[model samples]
Target: MTWKTLIVRVTDSCDGTCYGCLWRKNRISGFTLPVTTINDIVSKMKDFSFDESVILCPNPLYNPKISDIILSLKKVARKIYFFIPVNSLSKVRNKRIMESIDELVIVTTTPEDFKVNEENLKIILSQGFTNIALYVAIGSHTINMDNILSLVNMGKEYGLRIRVGEIPYSTALTLDIKSILAKKGYSVGFTYGMLYGYMASMAFIGNYPVTILAKPLTGECRKLFIDPYGRVSKCPLQTSYLRVDKVTSDILRSLIFSECSIGCRRFELIPKIEISLLTPDGKEIPSEVLSLLEVISHVNSLRAACSIMGFSPSTCVEKIRKVEKEVGIKLLISKKGGKEKGATVLTDEARRILEMYREIRDMVSESLYSEKGIMRFKLG
Candidate 1:
């Protein structure tokens, strides 16, 4: 089973504006919105049977109420991490917050921030936060190898680990960043942007083994996402809910056990079959002769029946001739090959036998359906 992670956007708004933020596109109405209540969040998390980590991402450090929410989350979350992006103005402060996290992530845009990031790294280290990771966003600007080398060297100096992630909205930059990181023995993590699903699918199929930090849990394992308003979503990217307001253990189990009602188009190709021998004209044929006629209905050609039954085509032809001679009626409608390939059809005599057999099959199915529930049988 695949491990799932949930990233909950605690606030509807952010303090500092980032250039390419996907959440900004889906903003509710105006500026600020109330954060999701702790009770609702915990209730949603408990619906799942399997273990999962939850990451909380608030707008910025400027929100005074964020600390209270973080404290509440720490109580319920199996594991928690913070993503703090550093820009020119607001820097890292409050060592207490850093110490509280399992992992502290710093997001940077440029090589110039390498020095500032290194300085911030010192502050996190000074606070005694051991698990610190850095992310450098390679955007439209040309990234110099020297700057990456400088950041790598700085990470070594501070005993901090570094990870590179592609900037959202730039395909060229994403490819370039991935190539550079691949050369350096690091893989880029995807945040919000185009082709996110494709990237995630590729990661799973390729067996990359890297953690997708904030995705909804699914399959036999019941991982999921909860919005700030307490609405549960399959993933943060989707706004629809598998369930809302209350995600109980019973509700989750019901969803897991329920079979998919969605039907497939292939059911239309299944041909009907029958098992008796009376003609539509009310003429009765012998049971032994009818059995041979029934085989012709299934495979119109003697050759086809022979292939299916693992008997010689000539033997099947002789059996058909013998049955027709006994019944005193035609059983095969032969067609000659030309541009269209040669084929055969069951004669009227054979079709009558098939219709009777189909009636018997339908009766049996109806009995089973009445005795046992439809849910007990697999739907085609």
Candidate 2:
């Protein structure tokens, strides 16, 4: 069987925190797949071709050699797509990506950038990116119609497709919002295949909602997730041992025709969640800091948590202490110990803070639907 799409995680090195994502929390420093490994995987796919495309998930910017990776995948894939973050974009990276990629799914926050004015966006779009799309998650709050139109207009101005995503609350995810989205504002017309095909394949392997636990009952899945370590997993979430050391043409082909299904009248859609944290005073705390705090809470050791995020113990100390001062709350209690007796524990206040953070996250996840509608989310 011929595979139409493949999800490749070229690198796990992200420069920023996405707030809702746990993948970037652990591997933020740097790690790129060696060219040899990538080349081997590409050469192995000699027997088949991708009619759709190969999606470079998350951020391709962190991979120094992403342009070359695109070139290699081009031989096997009809097109290439990238998931670009709003804040994480740089001119050089954008230029390189646009040159090599056929389409781009610009992952951005609708509420955050609503009033920011399109000056920067105007300048960036002027640089000329082709076949762009906007991806917004329906988190825990109800989005008003005005903001929804604003997001659609942005995509229209750029002559790009727009996709509004969430874990499916309704069994039949009718394209009701698509009708509103499909109405042209001021751009040329494009087909649904670009947006829907991309959305389906990408969502299939992603982590969100955390509700649906249906693993591929068959030996494989139609799509594959290739990570930076060159491991191939059956699902994008990549849990358990559905991973293989070697990925060949047969391996990828086997995945596409794996005869896998959830064995249900309908499969539950796992909503893609996004969360942002701010102080009661409305000052936004960097998600990276919150992630650090979360790690410390679980491990009960400041140094170990720092190590997990690839940060030095002292650096972590400075970050946490600075937040403590700013928030006027001590998050961690230190224990001076002899040799192995020393440990760090979260204060009661810190535990409360963590619980609150989790509440915000779960709220965003639940924001997948509201009374207004099932298709859009607005975060407060």
Q: How well is each residue in 1-380 modelled by candidate 2, as lDDT tens digits?
A: 32355667777766434334443335575677665655676777766676544444356677777778878878777667677655554433357667777666655555465334345555657776545555554432343446545665665555444455542111122232322322322111111122212323111011110011122223223555566776765435434323343555776667656554333213334343334466879665555566666656655677755543435578778877888888778878887876536678888987887677766754543333334434443232
Model 2, which residues run further than 4 Å from truth? 1-3, 16-19, 23-27, 91-96, 114-119, 140-147, 167-221, 241-247, 260-380
lDDT of 1 by residue, 128-183 (tens): 66665554444445656565556556554664445444442223222334323333
The reply for model 1, stretches above 4 Å from the true place, is 15-19, 23-36, 47-60, 88-92, 114-120, 138-150, 167-223, 239-380
Candidate 2, residue 380: Cα displacement in angstroms equals 32
Kindly report the root-mean-square deviation of model 1 from the true structure over all alpha carbons: 24.6
TM-score of each: 0.46, 0.52
What's the lDDT for all of these models?
0.45, 0.52
Q: What TM-score would candidate 2 get against the native?
A: 0.52
**Cα lDDT for residue 367, model 1?**
38
Q: Pick the candidate with the highest TM-score.
A: 2
